[model samples]
Target: MQLILPLILFLVGFGAYEFFETRRAAYKIAHRIHVNGTRGKSSVTRLIGSGLRESGFQTLTKVTGTYPKLVMEDGTEEEIYRRTKANIIEQARMLRYAADRQVDAIVFECMAVQPQFQWIVEHQMVRSTVGVITNTRLDHLGEMGNSLEDITRALCNTIPFNGVVFTSEQKMFPLMEKIAKKRGTQLIYADPETVTDEDLRGFRYVEHRDNVALALAVCQHLGIPREKAMAGLHQTVPDSGALEVFDVDYIPYKRIRFANGFAANDPESTILVYNLVLERFDNGGKRIIVLTIRDDRLERAEQLAEAIVQHMPCDYVLLVGDSTDRVHDVLTALNFPRQQAISMGVASGEEVFEMVLDLTDDRSIVLGIGNMVGKYKSGTQIVNYFRHRSHITPKLEEETRA
Candidate 1:
């Protein structure tokens, strides 16, 4: 009984200390921007940080994407080394780091998917001055919810109390606004019409118009001029998993164009990426789809398989990554041609590449979708293998956007 009292007292004291320290750290920074949503959180976080820095705010940013990173004030970024699986507590540590640096602003990509964690991250850890939702979509449904409305509600957990929030999600604006009002927050719609194709041409990658427009709106609200903010955005470093294309000569007579859309795992985002890449690079070649499936993301694999059957017209479907048998079965059950769907179970990057070559003719378009990183899948390796073999002219380098 005596020991129990002491243990309880120690636990309570530690909890109180942590709470005070975290809030203190958050208050030390002048501005805090919390970015959440299903699709473009990392891209929007990087954009806002770059623009804030350009406007002379000593900014720091942390993005959990294909490659997790910490973007410093001088626009230099360092990969965030993790010793274990990611946790929400990292936000507290990031805030402490930013407070120590005495930065003028910090933009964080929301890393929590579970609705409860999302609420705790924003209300307890970040307590952001500005919030950004980069468009809610059908993603993390296992953690967020099953429907789009459910996902939007889960994402709105990060909407700052008594502060302003922004989003480019036109369809869900009404629901978002209702939630924002209840929290004493004002929601603003970022009009993508303001961001022109000419502005997009300045990018070194195929950045979506909605992402740029959303980030621009956040920056403008922070008092950065559109001209200056755009200049910074143009110079912004894209996430490692950002949409990129490579045209490679695989053999003496064969050539292939590869587009990396592995990061867009959700059905809506995946379809958009498919349409974008197909529109830009379809050279009348055989359309090939390489879908990488993670063991834990079998549900996503099923979703993508259904979406592909309905939307993405293709000549062949190559299933890679862990537990390929399940996804192949899904494709077969969906009435996808059994012969066309090839299940190369847990294949290496080179093995997948070889299969892609075998499926391709003289000219082909190969689109990679689904999870980028997994215990068994290495989308980075596959992308790098193609990049190393690409002999396209110097003018068409990896830096070339569209």
Candidate 2:
């Protein structure tokens, strides 16, 4: 009985301390924007924070996508290395960090997938003034749910009460509006059509128009002019894993263009970007598709294989990483040509680099997709190898000129 009493007292004291700490940090920041969605949360968080900073507000942004990063007010970013595995409690720590810096605003990407954790992050940790949902897609169905409605409900848990919310989701607007009404928050639909092709041309890298429109709406609501917000977006640094292109002339008399779309794991987004690349770069060369499969993400691999069989055109499909057997089965079932679809199995980045060189001659394009998580020849690692090789060519040319 005596020991139980002390333990209870300790628990009560710890709970009270955490409660007060969260509230104290929340009170320090005036504007907090919580970005939630199945995809594009990191990009939207960066865009909103950039727009706020350009409008003369001190903003701190945290993104838990691709890799975690803490974007500072001056547009520089530091990697957020976690001593332990990811937990929703990181949001609380970010709030405390922002409070310590006395930043004018905070933009945080929702890292939690469970509904209960999402609610805790929204109501307890952030208590954000603005909530942004980029879009709802069929990713993370195991944690969120299996259906689109379930995914919508899971994402809506972050909608702030009596606050402003924005989203570019087209099909789920009615459901989102109902949730906003229940929470006494105003929901605004951000139209991707508002951003024209000309506007998209402003970005340094390839980006979806819908994400830009969603961020623009939030910045406009906060009283920043649209033009200024766009300028800030133009200067914004894309997440490290964002879609990037690299041209490699590693082998003598051989040229290869690698479009790194490993981060877009969903079938819809993946296929869209793949088609975009094919259309934009009509080099009439051999188009090779690389799928970096993750053991835990077999469903994703299957879906991507089906999508590719349905629409995408490629000369070769190289499957790497763990659990690529399932992807191979799907392709075989779909009657994909045996010669065209080859399972390379798990390979190191350097090994894959050599394989890519062997597969292509002076004219070929390699499109990388699927999850970028693995030990040896992960998507990011392969992309980095090609990127580094591509850079060396320029330096060699510069030295030759001198």
Candidate 3:
């Protein structure tokens, strides 16, 4: 009965999508564009939109990354609330809005898993002049499967059959080329070093690599120069809630500090942060003290705790959340020495911060990972206290990795 319900829903949703696509193509389109990938789809969308505007064209862009949206040139914006089947109809509605503005081009983030999925939303989407595939990353394992190869295949859904397709320096482009070949789309390649697009120096110098580079390359192909592209890139505003870094400060600590990597959603990224903290803090002077899982992420809180216990020589473990006791099972299962780990029954960030403050002096480097990966803001409060109240500076390591 449960399966039958979903099937009925799919048929109705698919049928409505097809009808929208057919009505959508009636608008005279100057060109259509689509962008996709794991990390930078939204960033790439903004860059391409900026490039189009610089190239003497009116551009409308929709970014479906961490935030969902509808963006138009006159500087007005609206947030979209979508139902379970994903934002297909909301996307079609955006295209219609763009058409009304007579925008010369449209750039949108592509999240579907197959070419057929692309055909459904895009059949009525703007007539894209180009296609952009930002570099791929290992995410959405349950949906795209575990292997990198599978992730690449899923992202290829955004590449159109006949239009120009541009991909970043992704490791799996050769395989993507084969997919493009079946559709007759020639895969064009781009790199940050090429400096062909626009000067993108003003964008915090941090977010330049991942998806922004891919966007610049696509923008350059649309006829915007390196200088003009840079201007547009700088001129481009981060359409609000668009993955921004807000305050930065520092603290002298024998007590370690965590950047709250909890915002991480998948195991792959969490593992990377684990290695980073372990490698950097293995100085043996002060030990790594981590608040493994935040509140609201108690479901897999034990998994994160387990991973941390195995990979690092943790001085102590502070578990936060209603599921704090679950972590004890893993420690026992692994036979980790009991002297080093403890669950404090879902402590608040204020309590955690106070405990760490009372525990150490000015020599400890606290590594906070998996803060954002979960479903809470405990990490933010900790970081903010150190930043706005204490005023310490941290050398952010993500851009170097990017």
Decoy 1 TM-score against native? 0.96
Q: What would the per-residue lDDT of candidate 2 be over residues 1-402, giving only the tens digit for each residue?
A: 889999999999998899889989998999999999977899889988988999998999999878899999999999998998899888898899999999999999999999889999999999989999988889887888999999999999999999999999989889999999999999999999999777777776767788899989999999999999988887779886677676777766788878888878899888888987776654567899999988778888899999889988788899998777778889989988877788888776677778878888677888999977655548878888878887534543332222
Tens digits of per-residue lDDT for model 1 on 24-85? Answer: 99999989999998898899899888888888999999999997899999999898888999
**RMSD (CA, angstroms), candidate 2:** 3.7
Off by over 4 Å in 1: 391-402
How big is the RMSD of model 1? Answer: 1.7
State the lDDT at 390 in candidate 3. Answer: 40
How far is 108's C-alpha from truth in model 1 (Å)? 0.4
How well does candidate 2 match the true structure in TM-score terms?
0.94
Q: What's the number of clashes in each of the models? A: 0, 0, 33
Global lDDT of each candidate? 0.89, 0.86, 0.61
**Which scores greater on lDDT, model 1 or model 2?**
1
Give the poorly placed runs of model 2, Cα more than 4 Å off: 251-253, 375-377, 391-402
Cα lDDT of model 3 by residue, 111-178, tens digit = 56554566665544544567777767666556676788888887777777687788874589889999
- What lDDT would candidate 2 get against the real structure? 0.86
- Candidate with maximal TM-score: 1
- Candidate 3 residue spans exceeding 4 A from truth: 1-29, 51-56, 74-77, 82-85, 111-119, 123-127, 195-201, 235-264, 267-360, 363-402
